[model samples]
Target: MLALNKIRPGVNGLAVIEREVREPGPGEMLVRVHAAGVCGTDMQLYHGAGAFAQRLKLPTTLGHEMCGTVIALGPEAATPQGAGRVKVGDLVSLESHIPCWNCNACRTGRAHVCPNTRYPGIDIDGCFAQYITVPTSIAWVNPPGTAPKLAALLEPLGIAVHATLEGRGVSGQTVVVNGCGPIGLMNVAVARHFGARRVIAIDPNAKRRQMALQMGADEALDPTAAPPVQTVRDLTHGELAGVVFEYTGSPDGVRNTFAMVGALGDVRWCATPGQPMDFDFGAWRKSRPTIYNIHGRRLWDTWDVAAPLVYENHIDLQPIASHEIPLADSPRAFALILAGEAIKPLILCE
Candidate 1:
């Protein structure tokens, strides 16, 4: 079995090594990894930016945004006999983070924010391995015609879905996405699909700004070239943005989020800030705009809405999937992302 592991901090090390996979425990199913998406969260883990790697018990397999095929089921599992609900070969996409169902947050239907959460590829062994055993509860069966490469993006799409839907519906509203990263680009399409009158995308990178336009942004603004706040306001006919999705973790981006939002509108922030942010409460108070800090995709809340978008071809991910490489070339894939050359790199794990 081949697997990629983060043996320690600040090093890729001998991450991809051969190993044997143990059999599934009770209530577990062994999945043969088919495809895994290299997410920004994975980059943060590689660079030791977030608290993810620090909390992890090291020498762990490192992959979370993944899809696989169920190969085996545990003895105690009720999975059907031959090719039952999910048989020997059933394509599936995993949710990655599974909450302790007994926790207070889980009981209150806030499982996405559950404090006691175990995430694959972060807190526990992940799909970087050729084979991974996971609880069936977190696995979703992909429809027959869904592309494995596209299926790998469902997790990140769920994030965009959750973030954009957090505010009052974006339909016929003006929206500005504060970053043009992969997730931010996804939001541009999502907001457009939901009937946002105008979608303004902001980024420092020239290529990404163009990519945002390609991905359905009505206007792409390079914040470094001209002030994005003024640009967004101008695009909105001096109305400011009815809704703003802040996906950049930089201080400038965060501060600009407050500036770009319309009075009495909502700002949905999904970026994980590495440091404390300095906010202008006076300005926010005066504007009376609402701020919504998004964590994980609102559990299953937004998935229902997003799944249909994908199923009905309302949002296409082909443009955003900038690179597709085999699992053996993961090191190169990581390098491409670290260099900011690739948008969404999907590794073929099968």
Candidate 2:
């Protein structure tokens, strides 16, 4: 099997090379990967930064968001939960977070933020290859005829769903998505579908701002051209946004996100910054907004809601999948993202 691996440290250390496929271990499944999406975490590894970057053992396959077919399952592969059962021919989308099932978080129904969580492409070998061997616990079986490319998007789409379903639920409220990245653009559509009164998207890139509008945002503002805080305030008629989804990890963007929220609103913080930045608690105290730190999706709960939106075609995801590249030429996918030419590029593993 051929896999895309981070063979060295520092920036741009990826290589596509041949490797023997490993058989599934006990309670694991061997999957024939069809398509995998390059995401922000993969970019972090490409730059050799952050906590996840430090945990990498060299020559690890670098993707987590993927759709694949089940080829074989090892002994005791059945899930104890009695749902999401996987058969030999099932198409599946992965939950990137591999939580320790014995933790208090898992037992108490908060497994999404389990302290002992391990991620694919970071803590273990991931799905950017012809064949991937993984624990069956993280796989979500799709309908028999799910499109491989769209099924590949379920994992990331789950993030947008999780954020939209957070505090206050986006219904009948003015919402602002402070970044127009892949996940942010998805949030724009999700917010609209969930009955948001108005959706405003903010980004410096004109292409993304335009994409945001196409995805259902009522307004898209270039943060570089005009101050986002004032623009959102003016657009909201000085009431400000009732809910602000923060996806930009930059210092300025973070500050603007706080400023754009109405008093007693909800700020769903989704993005993780590469470095720490200063924040004003005084300003935060004045707004008194409820802050929810969103991580990955709620195990099965988020998947149940997210999959249907895609399955039923309630929210169009065609615009988010900007490009597709073959697994052998997977390096170009990362390059396209770095150059800001593609939103989410799928590496076709099959």
> Which one wins on TM-score?
2
Whole-model lDDT, model 2: 0.92
User: What tens-digit string does per-residue lDDT give for candidate 2 at 1-350?
Assistant: 99999999999899998878888877789999999999999999999988888899998989999999999998778667423377889899999988888899999898898999988888888889999988888999999888899999999899999999999899999999999899999999999999999999999998899999999999999988888888888888899999999999899999999999999999999999989899899999999999999899999899999999999999898889999999999999999999999999999998
- lDDT tens readout by residue for model 1, 43-81: 878886568867767787888888888899877665321
- Candidate 1, residue 136: Cα displacement in angstroms equals 0.9
**How much lDDT does candidate 1 score?**
0.81
Highest lDDT: give the candidate number. 2
Q: Candidate 1: misplaced stretches above 4 Å?
A: 78-87
Poorest 10 consecutive residues of model 2 by lDDT?
75-84
| 10 residues in a row with least lDDT, candidate 1 | 78-87
Residue pairs clashing, model 2:
none
Error of 1 at 299 (Å): 3.2
TM-scores of all models? 0.95, 0.98
